[model samples]
Target: MALLHRAEIRPTKLELLSAWLPGRPWFQGEAAAGVERVAAYRFDDPAGQVGIETLLVRAGGGPVLQVPLTYRGAPLGDAEAWLVGTCEHTVLGRRWVYDACGDPVYAAALAGAVLAGAGQAEEYFEVDGHREHRPPSMVLTVDGAWRATAPGLGAIDRVEDGDPTRIVTDAVELAVVRHVGTEPGPAGARLSGTWDGQPAPLPLASAAPR
Candidate 1:
C-alpha cells in the first residue's frame, strides 16, 4: 500500500518536470507551453526505502510521455547525472528525485511487477490523522516466460535513451515506452497496461533476454 500526504510541495513535481523534461535526450518537443499530468502509477519498493512513480504527461497537445521517477531520502551519489532535481517534501522533508531508469530499485520493481502481472499499488491519502482510500490510476497484466524472482534480480547493466528507454538488466532487457503509441510491441512482451482514460491496453515495456 502507498500512503500519500495532501501537503504542499514548493516547486511542485510538474514544475520540476517541465524544466527537466525538455533537456532529456529522449524527450521530444517542448514543455514550455505547460504540461498536464494525465495519469500516474506507482510500484512498491520491497525494502520500503524508495518511492517509485510513473507519470504520463501531455504538453502542447503532443504525445503523452512516460516519465518514471524515484524519490529517495538521500542523494543517489552514483546517479548524479540522472538527477531530476531535489524537492522539499512537506511531510518527508528533503527528497532526492532521479529518473527511474537510473535507479536500481525502480528497475527491479518494474521488472518484478511485469513478471508477476501486478497492477498499480493500492493508495491512501493521509489526512488529519485519518486515511482515505484511493483507486489506482493504472491497470497492468503480463504474459510470456517471465516469472517473478527474488528481490533485486534485475540489476541494471546499462541504459539507452531514445524514443524508448532501454534498460539492460542481469535477468532481462526492458524497453520502457517513453512515448505512448497505439501500435503493439514485439514478441515476449511481459508487461501491458492501460492509462487512466485509455481504453485499450498498451504494452508499457517489453522484456527479453539480456
Candidate 2:
C-alpha cells in the first residue's frame, strides 16, 4: 500500500517533466508544448523509504512515454547523472527525484513485480488524522501467475536508454516500454495496463531472466 498527503508541490510533476522530456533519447519529438498525463501508477518500497511512481505522458501528440521516478528525502550518492531535479513537498519538505531506471531500489521493485505478477499498490490519502481511499488513475496486470523467483537485484549492472530502456540486474533484464504501442517485446513476462482512453491492454514493461 502507498500513503499520500494532501499537499502541493512546487515545480509540479508536469512542469519538471516538460523541461526534461525532450532531452531524453526515448523522446520521439520536441516537447515545446510540454507533456500531458496519459496515465500513472505506483509501486511500494518494502522499506517504505522511497516514493515510486511511473508516469505515462504524451508530447506534441506523439507516442505515450513511460517515465518511472523515485523520490527521496536526500540525494542519492554518485547519481547526479540520473537526477531529474528536485521539488518542494509541502508535507515531506524537499525531495530528490531521480530516474527510476538508475535507482537500485526501483530496480529491485520492478523485477519483483514482473517476476511475481504483482499489481500496482493501493492508495490512501492522509489528512487530519484520517485516512481516505483513493482510486488509482489506471489499472495494471501481469501476463502470468505468481511464480516465486529471485533475481540478483542488488546494484544495477547496466542500463541502455533506447526507445525501450533496457535495465539489467544480476540475474534479470527488463525492457521498460517507452512508447506504449510499439513492438510486442521479447518473449517473457510483461506488465500491461489500461485507462480511460486506453481500453485495450497495452504493454508497459517486459522482463526476462538474464
**Per-prediction TM-score:** 0.91, 0.95
**C-alpha RMSD values across all candidates:** 2.1, 1.5
Residues 1-210, model 1: lDDT tens digits? 778888777778888888898888767655777677988889888787899999888877778888999999999868987899989988899988899988888877776776555556788998889999988777777777445563345467888876678788787676788887733244555566786578887767766654
Candidate 2 lDDT trough over 10 residues, lowest sum: 145-154
Model 1, C-alpha of 46: deviation from truth (Å): 1.0
Model 2 lDDT per residue over 98-183, tens place: 99888888887887788786668899998789989999998888885346753556557888888678887777788888888775
Candidate that scores best on TM-score: 2
